[model samples]
Target: MKNTTTPPKIVALALLVFVGAVMLGYGVSRMSAQEPQGNPVTGGLLYDKWWTVTGADAPVGDHPLWATQSTNTRTGADTWRCKECHGWDYKGADGAYGSGSHFTGFPGILAIKGQPVADIVAALKGSTNPDHDFSAVLDGQALLDLAVFVSESLIDTAPLVNADKTATGDAARGQAFFAMCTACHGPQGNAIYFDSFEDPLVIGSLSSDNPWEFIHKARYGQPTFLAMPALYTLGLADSDVGDVLAYAQSLPGEPALSGGGLLYDKWWTVTGADAPTENHPLWATQSTNTRTGADTWRCKECHGWDYKGADGAYGSGSHFTGFPGILDATSKSSEELLAWLNGEANPDHDFSVVVDEMALDALVAFIQQEMFDISMYVNEDGTVAGDADAGRSLYAGTCARCHGADGKIYNFGSEDKPEYVGTLAVDNPWEVFHKVAVGQPGAPMPGALALGWTPQQIADVVAFAQTLPVE
Candidate 1:
């Protein structure tokens, strides 16, 4: 060991060199990994694009989401870049400029790089920006690439988003779209539900009911499974997106008038002045009570088109409600009838709230202008002039659903009064002729006019109604 051996010195020197090389290689790899993978080539080109509006350049500062940001400040192509609000890393004011005056608390799209192209496109097309959507600035492919980068490379936000759509999305644009929907669907979109069995789904119901589906559909289009039309097809501006969602979030989510009418047995309770009346004669005898159910809610229950109750059609079967027909009311003035509805002539039958002034006017209009005489066709013996056989064919095709073949399923009479179609046949024939010609109010009953029935065809129907049970 004491002998002079230079090998030890040489070995130590080689080891040092190897260690230094290894450290250098590791450092280079770390630096490379930290570099951003964003495609500036594609992103840069999309950044400066501009879309022309038909009208004067939208008022300078009127960006959809960023109300204060002026498009006029940016020259030529710079007016429409995503990087203006968001950073080069797609971090949006969350990265290098997060603390600057430009900071808008907006989230970065860098994390979404790996996401599906469709999602990215939707976000750009005002699907994501509640306040500031750039959809108008970018086309389909540009949006697709932007989304790809955000989904795959952006920082994970799973911890940030709550179960509801309140977090991680723009609420303003959502509100805007909701307003557009309110036109046909009512303010709440509950007027008509494509699905009847389930809870009536409105815009609020759809959003709160299923937030994921809401987000997915709101961004893209609604799933093919539903009847909802795609907002993209409507060419809505990007900025309007958040406005709609916000409005929808504020609306009532529960089903409207769900079971309110059943408890009162009054369609008038829900429909207000639009409720039907007991103008038909045979309305009393077909049901259990004259004041309830589908029958009492209808105007045709008491007065026949002939305005003759049991005297014409309700003289016999199930429709034999003994309420007096409206044949006599034809001579009554509009004021007199309005007073009657308000409980003047019939205090117990006050329908003031259910039948408002406008509705009363409609009823009076029907009575005064529309009522007619049918004595020539309808005999006291319940026989008609035209043809009963022909009438039967027409009834089966058109009038059978609600009226039934016998024309007597609902009764309109109270215990104190007993009236039916048979009673109308013998009493008043004019009211019967009127209803058959014009159709009953508030009921799905078809109008003879729309059905293209001839005067002779109507005469035949009256003949058959005369033969129906009225007792």
Candidate 2:
């Protein structure tokens, strides 16, 4: 009772304790009410192209921040992609985009790595600069994802990739990983042509020229191509991605022979021309093949898929014509081949009226460089002269994925007839050899030629294929 009335210090201490407790309770309440964190994988994809993932129409005009950069000549949607300004390496002007056409004098998001996620979210919502805001185009969840990606998923490619655009990992390990990619991009990485036909571009060239871009695309799936797998989601480590890039850089450049092989199958399709309505000038010479109009104009229709014409697979079928095979003609010079195509050798066989000069040159290359004498690997009875045991492992690695273990997943012929890989291997080994070496026309099947496989290796795959069920 004596001290209670005079203890102002104790009273002040009691008041401070009450205020501190109230503040702690409020902080916990705010933290508990915050939105759940976003997915970094989805965030990575969004960083590539948000509209594609969201199914929203791309913003009609340039991003507000785009006006601040004049070095990059790109406009509209391209100007808005985060990678366009910050670079594929995410180091902006300090990285791969420093001097190229993509340079934009912008800073990278790498500096924000490991920063508070909430702070990044605020910055994305225009807390820092109004021009940097992406709130109008993305919802709260999407913005959070972008922030999470910036804070958690961004890796400094500097240590992984060298200054000379080479990967700093083991290429041999990378080659094992590349087998998964062989289905879409052939073994030499030239199955698809990214640029114009006149000046084609393939993965081999792309990786060597821009390793940073290659690393980005390899980690995340391609922007518009949904079928492409993202290695990050597949559990590939940073070192693993670097290894794959190193192997890919060693692949062959420009696919001239592959392009020519496609032309040999259907010239009009490869050239993007409308098929001629009229039959070929020489169509009247062949009565067995009833196919008329555009069918008669295909190079394969006359020369055969094996390039042996009447002497090979097309000799006795409904596809038969008295036409001579072009295998022997492979010995002719480029000038002679051009003369035959242009009607100098035979006016009726002239193809210059349909295909251009460049196409003719490609045909010449195919005949001289790509064509193989199938008789060496395939016997007359449709059996392969190869080691089936040796081929088993090769086929399992290369052909089994698409064709299936039994080689019966795809039916090349009618459903009732059901022509599978086994059926073709047994019935038309010559055709098989040709297709195996040069790949299927307009299909994703990797050819042994593009894979740098030996003739014996191809023969081995054929032998293993023959052992599968024909039914």
Candidate 3:
């Protein structure tokens, strides 16, 4: 009837209107069927460490796809990490992990950045490779988040990190930004030991060694350590990230001798080991000190807080012991020290019974590297051999930030028996010198050594500290 009665122009107009209506209806239906976008930031963190992000225990056994690659020899939870398979640069086989220890020979997802989210999700569900299916470990929402990340958040990291693991950025600007990290990582980034106490690799070393990985973690925050502030979420620009990396790289990369110092103070406390129920095997040799149990096991109890044993602070007081000091052990080789620790020498002097090999190694390092003879700096009368006037300036500039202008900020002892920084410096200059040089363990205290200060400078700081109120 329309073909018989209607003109050609009207017929054409009706046809166009009908087609347009059908197209509009189809578009609306498609939009209604689509799911809401998932959180990409969550997705980025999940990519770094899925279990930590989801609060799930890391899956046991190697990922099914792990068997396909043999270059990366990491086992357990490490192999399950997405970054292990796909490179931090996101170029995978074509990028940093293409060879060397982390080589996986897997293609990266950078090429599929703009691909459909549904297609990416399907691939993750093993539509492409059955062995690559993550559905068993991740829920539907997690997969969607990951899909959104792949579709939206991934960036080309090639231009960000250099071949030598350095980044182009301003160190001074980075230093200011790094103040936020000081509480946990210390001024030189040596506060947290990433590996065993023996290895002593900290954040500074990690940043210098692998800037790309550092950048990734800095942007997404560390997994399991939820408190780590993500620069990305903080709205830091990419250039600022480079600046932070630059400052981190500039930090001291030496082993954390402070860990050894802490271990020496209380091995069980630092290592999280139970205190030995019995006295140390060498405890019976000492008769003067009435201390028992955990106190007897402390290296400082035997070696003396000044590390001179009978010759120093603990020589004849209530803390006294006839036990020899370890300051002499500094001259001995690491092998000889290790033998003494493992009982190859005198079995009674062996520390292996209570501590691990790494802890023992840390002790050896402390003896070798940190046990400097402070007799030149600290006199028998407990006075320092340094320029107190010069120290006043240094102390006012540095230590005053934490200890206060008058150095009476923190009362180390109780309110009834208050002890400030001055008390420690006056009572035990040796201890102050050691703490000043190596920094305090398990605290954010900066080390004079890390600050590029000389032995004389440290002595000066200790001298100035002695002048503060001791309550």
lDDT of each: 0.48, 0.78, 0.76
The alpha-carbon lDDT assigned to residue 297 of candidate 1 equals: 49
Better of 1 and 3 by TM-score: 3
TM-score of each: 0.31, 0.70, 0.59
Error of 1 at 304 (Å): 4.2
Rate residue 167 of model 1 by lDDT: 37
RMSD of 1: 27.7
- Give per-residue CA lDDT, model 2, range 16-129, as digits (tens): 434544553465457547846676656788888889988889878788888888988889998888888888888999888889799888988888899998999999888899
lDDT of 1 by residue, 81-200 (tens): 455566543566565436555555556666666667666656677676554555554555455435543554233223323445443445554543554343224445443333321334
* Ranking according to lDDT, highest score first: 2, 3, 1
Query: Against the correct fold, how does model 2 do in TM-score?
Result: 0.70
Which parts of model 3 have CA positions greater than 4 angstroms off? 1-37, 114-118, 256-258, 265-279, 285-296, 300-347, 350-471
Error of 1 at 214 (Å): 28
Q: Give the TM-score of candidate 3.
A: 0.59
Q: Look at candidate 3 and tell me the lDDT of residue 99.
A: 86
Give lDDT for model 3. 0.76
Model 2 error, position 446 (Å): 2.5
- For model 1, give the 10-residue run with minimal summed lDDT: 256-265
